[model samples]
Every structure is written in C-alpha cells, then in structure tokens.
Target: MPYPFRLNAVASLFVAIAPGAFAAEPDQIPQDMNVVIVSGSRVEHTSFDFPAAIDVVDASRIQDSQMRVNVSEALSAVPGLVAQNRQNYAQDLQISSRGFGARSAFGVRGIRLISDGVPATMPDGQGQPSAFNLDMAERIEVLRGPFSALYGNHSGGVIQLFTRDGQGRPTLEVNTAAGSDGQRKLDVNAQGSSAGIGYVLDVSRFETDGYRDHSAATRDQGFVKLTTAPTAGGKLTFTANSLEQDGTQDPLGTTWATYQANPRANEIDSTDTQSPKRTIADRYNTRKDISHKQAGLAYDQQFGDDRLHVMVYGGNRQVKQFQAFSKFLQVSPSQSGGVIDFDRDFYGADINYAFVRPLGDGKLTTTVGLEYGHSTDDRSGYENFIGNTFGQEGALRRDEQDKLKTMDPYAQAEWQVGQWVLTGGVRRTKLTVGVNDAFLSNGNDSGGVSFSHTTPVLGALYKINPLLNVYASAARGFETPTLNELFYSGSGAGFNFGLRAAESTHLEVGVKAIVMTNTRVNAALFQVRTSDELVVDTAIGGRTSYKNASATLRQGGELSVDTKLGAGFSGRVAVTVLRAVYDEAFGKVTTGSRLPGVPNANAFAEVAWKDKSERIGAALEAIASSNVYADDANADIPAPGYAILNARFNARQTWQGWNFKEFVRINNLLGRQYVGSVIVGDANKRYYEGAPGRNWMAGIGANYAF
Candidate 1:
C-alpha cells in the first residue's frame, strides 16, 4: 500500500471517531483519571503534570492482550516506540525508541529498563526483558525525550515495570492458557497482608512449538516481594526473582530469495554435510540455554520535611548458545567458532536524599543521589564440531574475563511557581572497563578503555488553563559501547578500544490537554542530532564488529488520543511519523539514506466495550506500520507495510468467595502474511523474519480469598 493511502485510511478513521470524542455528556463522564509516573522523575507526579512524553500501561491491559509473551503486546498503542516480536525466541524482542537501538541484533540497548526500582540494564546499557512477570505487574511506565537523559548512559528512553504489593486478605489465583502453534502457559500466584507485613509470590511456566521451523522454547519464571513498616516513619522492601530457559531455538534470519521460497526455511538447506538432509538450525542444534537470578532490597524513611531512600541489588546470569557456522568459516584461525558460553555477576547500590522547603510563595523540592554498579563476565568460545560429530563443543577458540564498573553523582530540582513548573537535573558518570585474556594461544591482546560524561536536562511546563499544559525540554545524552560490542577486535581476541562513545542532543516540545469531559489528547515534536553514531563495521558468519559514523539525524512527531464513548465504550489512537537518516556516510552507507530497522510511520487504534456490571467485555484492535529497511546501504530487500486486526472477548463471574474468569483472543484476523522483524545489516543478506498468520489463544483463571 502507498504511504498516502495508509495515511488517508487512518485520517478517515480519526474523522469518524471525532464525533464521539466531542459529544460529551458531562454527567456520563467518569471521574477525572490521573496516572502517577515513577520512571521520569523517580517520584510521583501526575502524567499530564510531568513535562515529558510518558505513557502508562496498566495491569488490565497486560492481562487482556493476545501475546503476553513480550512487552510488545500492550505497547503497540504507544507512539514514538516500536516493539517487534521476531518469533525467533533466541533474539528476544526488537525494541527501539525513535531511531535509537535500531541496529541491535539481540537484547536491548540505548534504552534503560527498570523493574521495581532495580536496574535491568547493566552499566554498559545492554538489557534483557525476558524476566518481566506480567501476571503480577501493577503498571509499566515509559518515559521518552530529554528527561530520560537523567538516568545516565544509554538514556534514549526508559521502560520501568512496577509489580503489585500484597493487600487486603490472603488470596490465591491460578491461570492457564493455550494457543495456536501448540503454545501453553500456566501461572500461580499468592498474596496477603498480616501483622504489618505484606507479601506476594508468583510462579509461571511456558512452552511453545513456535511459528517457524526449528523454533521451539520452554521457559520458567518466579517472583516474590515482601514489604513491612518497621518504624513509625520508615519502610523496608525485599524482592527476589529468577528465570530459566531450557531450550530456545535460534531460527536465524533468511535471505530475500530464501524468504521468497519459504519464509520459514532455515539458513542451511538439505545438501550440507552437518546433516545432508536437514536444515542447519535443526542439524547443528542452534539454540541457547540460559538461567538468571536477581534480588534487591529498598529502604525509605521520612524525618519531618526531609526524606531518605536507599537501594541495593545483585544478580548473576549464565548462558550457553550454539550457532550454525559453515565449515569454510571455521577453517580460519581468526574465526571465534560457533559455540558461546558466558557467566556474569552484577551488583549495584543507590542512595538519595530529598528536601522540600518553601521558596517564595511556592514550594521547591531538591534531590541529591549517588549510584554505583559493577559487573564481571567470564566468557569463552569453542568450535561447534569435533571430527564427524556435530552439535558438540570441540576446540577452545577464545577465552577472556571482562569487568565493568560505573559511578555517578546526580542532583535534580523541581519548583512550583504559581501557574508554572520548572524542572532540571544533571548527572556525572564515570565508567571503566577492563579485560584479561586467559588463552595465551591467541597471545595477550588484553586492553581496557575508560569513558566519562556529564549530562544535563532542563524543562518547564506552563499551565495555560486548568486542563492544558505546554512544555519544552533539551538534554545531552551519550551511549558507550556494550560489553558484547567490545568482545572482539578485528586485529585479534581483544577489546575494541578504538570504538568511541556516541553523543546526542535532544530537543522536544509537547502539549497535554483534556479536550472534553472524557477526552484527552497528547502530542509531541522532537529532534535529535548525534555525533559519532555507532554503525555496523563488519558482519561475517554470525560474528560482527562496530564502528562510529560521522553523524546522524532523527526528527519525528507523535500524537495520541484517548476518549470514552457514550455508554460503556472507550477508544484510543496513536500515530507516529519519523524521518531518520544518515547525515554523513560511513563505508557504503550514503548520506540521506534511511536508517535501517525503523519504519517511517506507524499507527495503532483500539476500541473496547465493557459493562457497568464488570462481568463481560470485548475489545477490537488494529496495528499498522510502514515499510522498513534491513540494511544500512538501503538496497537490501525491505519489509513491506502491513496491517493487522485483532479481537478479544472476556467474561467473569463471582460466587461465594471465589471468582472465575475466561478470555479468548484472535490475532491477525485478516490472515496477513508479513515480515515481523529483521536483523540489521546482515552481511549475507539474511535479514527477514516472518510473522505468523491468523492465530488464537484462550485463557482461564480462578481466584479464592479468605
């Protein structure tokens, strides 16, 4: 479809919805709703009152989504953010805010991820979101734009998940679901409060046959939280969580010809020696097995108008992965082989003090904080075959230990002056990375790099009317190379000390308004200019290198509307338009070329119907995106524009002290055949990953209280 045609379709729908948006029955309007955000300010502030682009996804939305396996399920309606499920479990989700983190092959970068006050992103900015437990999530807050820089490195944006604390009486709940492609999931949870103590615990298991060949996975997760008030003005909280993935298949990407032949086909065909009659992913057993455990403690106390908060957290992760490397590549001495093993230990602490006092007729609040974090990695690589035997570790290729440490001092202030609010923050970060080469066979190519930066943001919001606010902000942010990026230097087995950090300047202006009694609208315009932008230097046989580009530019706008229709229907729509391109060329990439892995335009719309009795409900959703490029050269095959329709129906009943509910969701109702995601800048041009056609899932749950 043409871009203009798609825009027209979306515009027509907006016109059709305007009637209901403006036709407001004051008496029918529900009480004004205010969402409190914690990610942007590390404090509580009404969403509209916050001078940034922030979005909140509540538990109800998460529980009612079709694909609860990833954050993409509930975030489709959020503008300025793109989340794609690759259907290849090994790579996890492909997430990007604006033009940031678009080139990542696996895991997330250029964005900060937090869970219940604990950092999921390491000091190097690499993050994994597979451990998020949706069953117990109270809310997820997404902060974008300049204010995100306050979080230090890789602060292009922030996604923070806060779980629910136990309340009321002791209760138990169980949930189970089954879906297309032989997917199954089960969850159990318990919560209660007693003797000034509150507790919540949840455990879940999931398995899938997957949508493509050689794509299958089984996963387990557990979470627990305990909270108590030990003194009159003090509170303490402890949280623990663990995740395990026994088998996650890596289907890998496919070439344009191969995708045209069979989108589900693996990289290797039937003539390879590894199997002679099977695909490479199946024959070589390309997969990853992983285990992770994390725990954290938080303390809060108040003394008159001054407050104190402290947090301590630690975690460890172990992973083993097998890849499909051709025999020719394995013959080279420089090749790192196809088997990877890594164990990581990370720990961090944060302490802050807040003071509130009177300034003139208004009030001024100031916060001072310090944070420290450290991580160590024991990494090794080995050949995937020995003699005629495949799928087993052979000769050791690379072995090393890498360590990263970071310390930051930060301060922020917010002042209320009559009809205006001023906010500002600054953070000074110091980071050091070191490596030790343990395998003398490759020579001692060990070296380290250190980086330091100071980022600051300033913003102001003016309340023109009781229901309208306008704000503008600007900030400087920087991103250091991730540990994985530094793992290999083209010269040999050593750190990539030649790589430089990318720095950016972000500017944004936005408005928030209550257009009607039951209608709200928010919009923002943003621009970012980056120096020494990171780009893929080389990618060969599953191994990659990175370098810095001269410059890049990103400009975009986002619009969102939420309104409550008459009776029990509510509707929401969000649209994003972006123009991201290289300002200066690097290698074969040319100036003015569109950045890879980002769609120029995307939109989401949803309408839901519920009853006052709260026993029955239904929802209809639509998601659409423009075409996206898969390579920096802008000439490799592109994923075409696509639209998907989904419907969900749910109902619940209460009897005695027990509650029972059921839900059914149908996705891709139009049976759309399209590419779901891509691996950016694949040297062999194997970049496409296909999405599944029409699928369905049904779930049932029961809760009992005493």
Candidate 2:
C-alpha cells in the first residue's frame, strides 16, 4: 500500500523526518561450476545436495556492505531474511524462517547455532544472541530445516558463524564511526601467517546516547584466533569471545490510558493519573558481562573404504548477569529493592565421525556423533526496604542453585545416484536436572530431572535440470524449559511454575535455481504444527505460570535472489511472507494471526559499485518491513511499518590525485523517526515505542599489507 503523496505534503507540517534503512541483492561474485557440498545438507551429494535449503554470507561482502552496528540488520543483505532488535541495545534479537518461529531470550527457533564447531548455546541451550564481532567474521553459513537428526541436540536447523582464519595476504585494518544520539565506535583488526602458524586479533568499543529517553547503550568486545600445525595429518585451533556492556532501557512503556493519551511518551513521563505521586527513580538499570574459552583439534586422512574425518572439541562459558533498580513510587516508593548477584557456568565435549564410500553409480556417506555436557547455576539475592518494622536477622537474604547434564548420540546416512538422492537419520538424548532453594517456603529440595524421547529427520533432494532442483522434507523439533522458568518465584522475570516441553513438526517443499548466467534464487514454502506450547495461566490466581494448553500452526514462503549488476557493481534482494496462529481453549484463532514481533513481510535491496584500482566505491541500499503484531494475543493495535533509505560514498584517492588505501561511509543520509520492532510488546497487546528517530552514522575503514 502506498501512502498518498498529497497527504504527505499536508502532514509535513507536523512530521519530523529521522532517516535510516534494508536491501538484499544478488551474490557479488558468481561461480559458474561445481556442485559445492554445503554443510546444512545432512545429505551428501547432487545439485540439490540437501533437501533443506541453505544460505551463505562470505567475508568480502561483509566488508563492502557498510552495515552499521546492528549485526542482524546487516545480515538482511542476504536474501530470504530480515532481522530486528527488541530492546535498544539489550542484544536480544528475534529471527524467523519460512514464517515459523519460537520466541526466546536466546539461541533461535528451528536453527542450531555453532561457532567454530562449538555450540554457541549455554548448557541449557539458551544462546547469547549478541556476542558477535562482525569485523572478524570469516563467513556465516545457514542450513534451514526441521531435519534435526544430524544435530538433534537442537530442533532448529543450523547456522554456523565462522571467525576469521586470516588466509592469504597479511592484513591490518582500522574502522571508526560517529552517528546520531552521540553514538561513536572504534574497531581494529589484524591478521598474518608466519612460518607454519597464523594469527588473528581484533578489539572494538561502541557507545550510543540512545534513541529514546534513558535509552543509552555502550559495549566493548575483544577476540583472538590462533592456528598451528604439529604433525602433517593434524591441526589445532584456539579462540575466545568476550564482551562488557551497560545500557538504559526504553521510553516506550505505557499503560492503556498513557498509550491512548500519548503512545510516544517516555517511561519517566507516562503514568496513570490515579498514581500521580509516582516517582521515576524506581525504573530499572541493567548490565552484563560474558566470556568463553574454546579450543579444538581435527584429523583427516585416507583409510581404506573411506577418507576419515574426525574432530573433538571442548569449551567453557561464563556469565555474570545483573538487574536492579529502586523507586516504583506507586507500588511503594518507600521500598527500594533489587537482586544483588547471579552467576552461572557451562562446560561440554563433542566427538564426530564422517565416512564415505563409493557405491554403484552413486556414493554413500555416513556420519556418527557423540556429545557429553553439563551446566551449573548458583544464585544469591537480597531485598530491603525503609519500612517501619524490622523482621529477623536474615530476613531478606536468599540463595538458590540448579545443575544439569546431557549425554547424546546420533547417526545419519545419504546415498545418491543420477539425479535422485535419499537421506534418513535419528538421535536419542538423556538429560538430568537438579536444584536447591535455601528459602523454600515448603522446606524442601527444589530440583528434579527429566529425559526427552527420540527425535528424527527424513528428506530427499532431486535435480530437475542443470539450472534448477527441487526438494521436500519432514522432521520433528522440541524445546525444554529454562532453569528460571522452573524455580525462581518472586522476581518479575522469575517463574513460579515449570514449563512443559515445546514441540513441533515441519514440512517443506523448495526449489534452488540459477536464474541466469549471473543470478541465483532459492525459495521455499513450509508449514509447522506445534503442541504443548508454554503459556501463562493468570486464571491460576497468581503470577504467570506455564501450561501446555496452546497449539500453534505456521505457514510461509522465503525467496532470495542475487545477481552481478556489472563488472564492479552487484546487487541482491529477499522477501519473506509468514502466518502464525495460537489455538487455545479460551480463544480458537485461525491462521493469519501474526506471531509477536514478526512482520507479515520483509524485503531488502542493495547495489554497490566499486573501482578497486582507484580504491574508490559507492553503495546504496533500502530495507522495508510490513506491519507486525505487537502482542502474543494477536491484538488489533500493531506496530506501524516503516522504510529506510541509505547511501555511502568512499574514496582512497589522495588530495593531489594520488591515492591512499582508505575510505569512508555515511549512513542515514536523511533523518527519520522509527521503532526498532514491536520487540517490547506488553501482555496488554500493544507495541512499545522505538529508538532515536534520526541518526547520522559515518565510519572510515582501511587495510594495509605487510
């Protein structure tokens, strides 16, 4: 739908423009030959190597794109994808595929996330959604499917984000930027190979004044990668990912009356007239720090009937999480309280084997894997108020703890002949959960363990012609409740009751084709049926508790296309359409009901023209999303949709017509007001207001050869 130009002319009197942007284009470099065996394919060979579709984001494009601080937004350059944040800089993100989704604080739905062969997820499978260092990223590979057997530990498909290996020429780079709301950034990266060893190091600092009132965010990150060769047949690699940050929340929270009066009011100003005495000091101030250590070894060699490939990995992940604030004046301004501390640790090991054999006119590939892991969560907290009466010596002190362990095994096989391929696999998992609560009102141990049944994947891929192929597949996926959801009771984010397992079955049919000599497009249509969905039962007469009364259905299509515009110019575009619904006893909703934060359709387009010899280039891009549902109840009030247009100009030419090896980019050329997403939807079924309206971000980048 197009907004009337005439209306815009009249509305200009009251509107202030804040500008920014989405666009996807064809792959920059086109490959004419080879049936590349991509990882997402649990299947072995053929043009449509795997029944489930896959997308890859390589390094060269990452650097050329001029993407800002939003990792997910930059990724929109890839077709069939769109991403947005829920909070200003909370690093909390939501991603969807084929219109199906599972909303959580971390990890992702129907997709497994592994970085450097290590599960990026914590022991509970709750992943850290914002720890990425885009500057050092080597490539991002995605596998879409419910075919979970290969890595059944997670029901979603798999997305592997590989850090830089520092191949070929030695490189040293520095990047800096300044944008709207006093946002600033400094990023540095370096890599080189010497003798028989290679090394990579990177560090960065990013800060923002925030879009809305009290919406500021700051982040610091550092990473390193090392490679060594000992024996001729083996190699060892070590890496670390870490971050520290502090941020203010949003100004968009509002009660029904405040929203009706002014949905755009900041948190400190919005209020219920009945509670006019309320003070803003009670608002929340949050912060966090996360660090991980990882290392691994791999061996590959020929062994009779098969070429052996083996990899073993182990790592430790630590999180220091904090949240607190004093001053809910209306609830009790005299009362000041918060959680003093929370800590957790995760550790794990993995072993994998892949063997291939030549058979008939085709080939056979078999893979076997084993995993053993454990997690521990220990917490202590305190709450105090300026009340008239004093209670006991240890009245407000409390402690709680939980531990979990998992041991799993899985296998799969693929056989291919002519244009036909077959694949099948299964996985069995064993789990145990234990907990302890020092302040248990019932005076009891508060922990228990549970095991999940087996989940499997089945699919096939067919080649229709040299330029195209088609596939169909079916598989099962599930999610277990988190520790906080089962034991914590008093904290607002804490849970009073346990949640049941969340499960779904996905079926899809898709096609992959090279549209022309320089363009390729991949598209898929999928549907999912889910049961035992976790939902709040306020009717239980207390805080939100989990129940399995909800059933859900999702259906959608994804299309991505990329092409070479010309010698030094290229472009890409992607679109997604989705429908999700929740069918519970209280409300039997039909299809087309949108999921929380999910837009009905998302699209992107980008074009870049470069002159490498002169070290000069310019790029233009546009990204737009349709309206989205701001609440889980599928309410009528939606987050109005908006579009962003951006442009960049870079040059390495010297002042005297000579040339240097550096360039710069400017973003949000036109300022515009916009919301990040219905990301902060309330239970009342309304959307949260978004961040700073107009931002002007500019950055300079350079690379030098040793």
Overall local distance difference test of candidate 1: 0.85
Q: Which 10 consecutive positions of candidate 2 have the poorest summed lDDT?
A: 16-25
Clashes of each: 0, 29
Q: Pick the candidate with the highest TM-score.
A: 1
Model 2 Cα lDDT, one tens digit per residue, 1-706: 1111133432331122101000212242245322443464432343335677667777655554343355574566654444565445543556555443344433344345677666766545556546666778766766665664356544455666777775666877778877666778888888888777788888888887765554567777777877766666555677676666643342334334444454344444234353454423123333344444555554444445444445555555444333323223246433323333456666676666667787799988887877767777676654433342111111234467778787778777787789877777777776667877775643555658675757777888777655555677888877665554454343443444446677778777776665545666666777777787654332110112334557776666677767777778977777766666664443533444556666767787778788757367777877787776655566556666777777766666444422234444544445555555553234433245553444455566666766
Task: Estimate candidate 1's RMSD in Å.
Answer: 3.7
Give per-model TM-scores: 0.95, 0.82
What tens digits encode model 1's per-residue C-alpha lDDT throughout 363-400? 89899999999999998989887766556788998788
- Which 10 successive residues of model 1 have the least lDDT summed? 1-10
Highest-lDDT candidate: 1
